[model samples]
Target: MVAPARLDLDQRGDTWSSLPDHDVDVLVVGGGVTGAGVALDAVTRGLSVLLVEQRDYASGTSSRSSKLFHGGLRYLEQLNFSLVREALRERELMLTRICPHLVRPVSFLYPLKHRFWERPYVTAGLTLYDSMGGARSVPRHKQLSRTKALRMVPGLRKDALAGALLYYDAKSDDARHTMTVARTAASYGARLLTSAKVERLLREGERVVGAEVTDVESGETATVRCRVVINCTGVWTDDVQELAGGRGQFHVRASKGVHIVVPRDRINSETGLILRTEKSVLFVIPWGMHWIVGTTDTDWDLDKAHPAASRADIDYILEHVNTVLAHPLTHDDIEGVYAGLRPLLKGESESTSQLSREHAVARPQPGLISIAGGKYTTYRVMAADAVDAARPDLASNVPESVTEHIPLVGAEGYHALSNQVETIALRQDLPAWRVEHLLGRYGSLVEELFAMWAEDPSLKDPVPGAEEYLRVELLYAATHEGALHLDDLLARRTRISIETKDRGVTCARPVAELVADALQWDSGRVDDEVKAWEARVAAERESQTEAADQEANAERLAAPDFRNRSVGRALA
Candidate 1:
C-alpha cells in the first residue's frame, strides 16, 4: 500500500478543485516549523486542520536560521534559567527521541581571553550546562590549557586565547526537518498546501469563521471555512493580527540576523568554535562541507521576507571571528551569504539582541488566535501552548497535546536503518555517501524514493550541475514535499542554491523543467519561473553588498512579493 504523493502548489489546481465547499475546524497560516507543528498537534487531538502558506515550506526565516537546535548558552548567562531548561529538554528530545536522524550532537570550543579568572568562571557555567536534563546525549565539558587548546586547533592565532572549554549542542537541517514534520501532519489527515495565500479572514458577526485563500499559481480563489484561525506567521504575526481587525492582545518585533558561509578547509579545525562578540555571540559552525559563521542582531524595519546583510554586518562578524584566526577571510572566501528576521517579543531596549526570545499567545478575538516570538528550539512547546489556548474557542473539550509522544513520519525506526546504509547502497548500485545522505534526510522513507529510481535507472544519476543531489530528490520534492517553482526545490527542498558556489545558477533550468511538468506549465510559464528565480537570486546578492542594513533591506524588497497583491499585498 502506498500513500499518494503530498499535495503542493503544482497540484493545487487538481487537489483543491474538489475540496469540500464547507469549512474546516481550523485554518493555520504559515508552513514553518511552528506552523507545521500546530497542524500536527491539532490533527492528533481530533481537530479538522488545514494549513496554507504563501511560498514553499521553510522558505522564509526557518531555512535561513543558524541550523542549531540549541539551548542558547547566552540565555543562561542572562539568568534565564527557565528558557535554558526548557530548550535543553527540547534539544534532548530532538536528538534522542523525536527526530534523531535529523538532529545530532555537535561540539563547540570557547577560547578564554583572560587566564585565571575566565577559566573558573567559564568552567562553572559549562559544568552546569552539561548537567542539564538528558545531558547524557553528549560528553561533558572539558577544560584545556593554552598549549593543548592550540594543539587541538593549530589554525588559532598564538595570542588569541589563554585556554579553552569544549561543550555540546545539537544541530539539524532546518528545511528538511520542517518538510518532514509537515508530511507527518499530512499522514495524520491534516490538509497541507503551499503557495496558497490567505487573502482575508472570513468573519461572521465579529468572529472569524474561516479564511479566503488564493492559489498563487493558477489565480483561483476558494473559501475555506473553519471554526478557528491560528496565525503562526512568525515575523508577520503582527500583520496577521491586523488582518483580524487590529484587535490582537500583544505585539511582536522583527530583528534581523545575517550569516556567511565559507568552505570548511578555510578554517581547519577538529571542532566548531564559539566566540564572544561585543554585542552578541559568533559561531563558526561545521556544515557538511562548509563553515557557517555569523549572526548580527539589529532592529529591522525593512522587508521581512528578505532581510539583507549590509557590509557593516559582514565586517562585524569577520572582524570578531578574525581576532582568533591565524588567517583572516575576505569577501573572496565567502561562498554564500543569507539573512533572516527573528520574531522577538518587543521590549523597551533598542538592541535587537537584548529583546526577549520568549513567545506569547493571544485570542484577540472570539475565533482568532496568534502566536509569536520564540527561538526555533522551542517550536514544539510553542505549538502545544497555542493549541491549548485556541481550544477554548474550538468550543470542545480537546484532549491533551499528543505530539510529544508522536514521532514524525520518518523518525520511527531510523537508528537501525542508518546501520544498513552501506548494504543498501551496494544493492542499489549507488555510492555509500549518497545512500547516507538519503537516510539522513528521509530515514526509512528512502526506500519509497529509491523505488522510483529503480523503475528508471537514469534517475539514479546526480542532478546536472548539482552533483551532490540526485534527480530522484527533485522528483521527491515535487511529488512528496509539495514544491511548486524551481526556487522551492533549489532553495528549500534541497538547499543547492545556498550550498553551491555558483548559487545554483546552472541547475535552475533543469529543476524548472521538472516543476513545469508537475504544475502543467506552458513555455511562457516556464520562462517566467526561470526569470523570477534569477531575479530573486540577483536581488539577494545585491542586498548583501549594500553598505547599510536598511539600504540592503530596501534593495532586497525589489523582487516580486509572494502575497497576493490583489488583496493581501502589504505583509507589513
Candidate 2:
C-alpha cells in the first residue's frame, strides 16, 4: 500500500509547485469538517482534488463546537425525527467504523422535574434515540430514583431532581476530529492547502471554472483550475455565495454558542448532565480533566470570524448552571471559555434556536456548487450530497462516495495497540496512563512518536508549563500536522489554548521554540510567532470582560493576526 501523504512544509511546497500542472476535478473552498469531508469523498471517487482554507483548519465553528456527537435530543421536542436519525447513524459510524480513536461514547443524565410525566417523557425519547440508528455499542437508557440520582451527583442540590434517566451519546475534540478528516483526505491524494485564501472566483463568462487563490503567508497568487468548485465555508457560506454570484435559495444566520470549561473537581458528578432551560437545553459535559458546562444559543450579527464570549454571555451560563448546584461556581472556577457560531438555515422564526439545523445544497451556477447549514455529526452526509449535486459537471459515471467503508488514518491497528498499552509504556519507559493518553490522542500513530523519541531521547519529556502534553507533540504538529503558525499548534492542533487556565500563555515561548525547530524558523520568526499568539490570548481575555458583543469584537479585532503580522514585518 502507498504510504499516507505527509502534510509537512516540504509536501506543501511540492503541492503548490504541482498545482498549475494538473486540472483538479473538485476545488473545495474551506478547511472545516464539511470541506475536508467533501475533499475525501471526491478524491476517493477517482477525482483529482484541491482544498484551500484562509486560516488554520477548524479555526472556526468546527473547533469551537459543543464537542458532542449527539443525535440532538432537543430536536425530538420539535419532532425532527429525520435529522435525529441521520445524526445518530453518523455518530455510530464515527464510534465504530470511521474514527473510533477520536470519537467515543459518553453518558449524560436527564434529571426529572415532575414525578410522573417527566420520567415517561424522557424515557420514551431516549428509547426512540437508542433504537433510531440500531445503536448497540452504547448502553441503553436506565431509569434512576431521586436518591440514586443525588448519590451519583452529590454536587447537585437534593431539591433539584425528582428522579433521573441516563442515556449515552458520543463526543470528540472537535478540532482534532476535523484535522484528522483533512489528513485522511490528504492520505487519499487530495491536495490540502492552508493560509491560501480565495481572492476571487475565476469565472469564464458566468460559470466559475476555478479560483484565484492568494497565499496569506506570502504575497503570492495562483489560479487553480478545476471542473467544479464546492463552497463549504459554514458561517461564511453567504459571503462565498455572494462571491459566486448571489445567495442562492436560502440565507444562513449566525447563532452563537458559548461554553465554559472548569476543572472536574468543581462538578462532583460521575456522568454528564443535561438540563432544560426556558428556551433550550444545557449540557454539562465531562471533558478529560475538565467539565465543559455551557452553551447559550442566541442570534449573533457581529463578526462571524471572531465570535467572542462577553461578560453577559458568561454570566448567563453560570447563572443558569448554578441553579441546581449545591456549590455555586464563580468566574474564578472557569479555566477556559470559548464561543462558536452555528450557520443555521434561516426561517420565519425570530429566534436563532428555532432555525433549522437541516442543510441545503445548490448548484447556484454552472461550475459552482455550495453546501450550507449542517451539524458537525452529519458532515459525511453533507459531503455526499455536495458531490451528488456536482454530478452534472463531473463525469457521467463519477463513482459514488465510498468514504463510509474507509477508516481514517491511525484507526487500522488502534485496537491491537490499545490492548498492548502497558507493554508499549514499559518499552518506551513512560507511565501506563501516559501511554494510554497518547493512544487515545494519536492511536497507532503513537508509534511515529516513539520512533522520533528514539532519534532524540529528549522528545519524550513533557512540555515545560503544560505537563499533560509531550514535547514531541509540538514537533509532530509542525512536522506532520500542517501547523503553519504558533496559533495553529496551540489553538487547534493541541487545544492547549482553551484547555489551560492561563490560555497557553505560559507555555507559548517553549512551544513556539519546539515548533520552530521542526519548521526551521530563525530567532526573529520565533519571537514574532510567540508575540502574535500572546497578543491573541490577551485579546480574547480582554474581550470576555466586555459587556457587549460590539465591544468584544473590537477588542478581538485589535489583535494582529499571526500571518498578516509576520508578512507585514518581513516586507518592512
Summed backbone clashes in each candidate are 2, 0
CA-lDDT, candidates in order = 0.83, 0.89
Candidate 2: residue 87 Cα off by (Å): 0.7
Candidate 1 lDDT, 1-572, residue by residue in tens: 12424665534555577445646787889999999999989998988888998887887789989999988888889989788888888898888878888898999989999977988888888887877755678888898888988888888998999889988998988988888888888888888888788888878888988888887865788888888899999998988878777567777888888899998889878889999988889999998888999888888887777678888888888888899999988888887888888888888988888888988989888789899888899899999999998987885788999887888767777888898888888899888899888888887788878888889787788888888899889988887778777777888888787778878888888877765766676876666666666767788788878899778877777766533333223222
Q: RMSD in Å for candidate 2, one decimal?
A: 1.4
Error of 1 at 21 (Å): 2.2
Candidate 2: residue pairs that collide: none
lDDT of 2: 0.89
Locate the minimum summed-lDDT window of 10 residues in model 2.
563-572
Summed over model 1, clashes come to 2
Assess every candidate by TM-score: 0.95, 0.98
Minimum summed lDDT over a 10-residue window in model 1 is located at: 563-572
CA deviation > 4 Å runs, candidate 2: 565-572
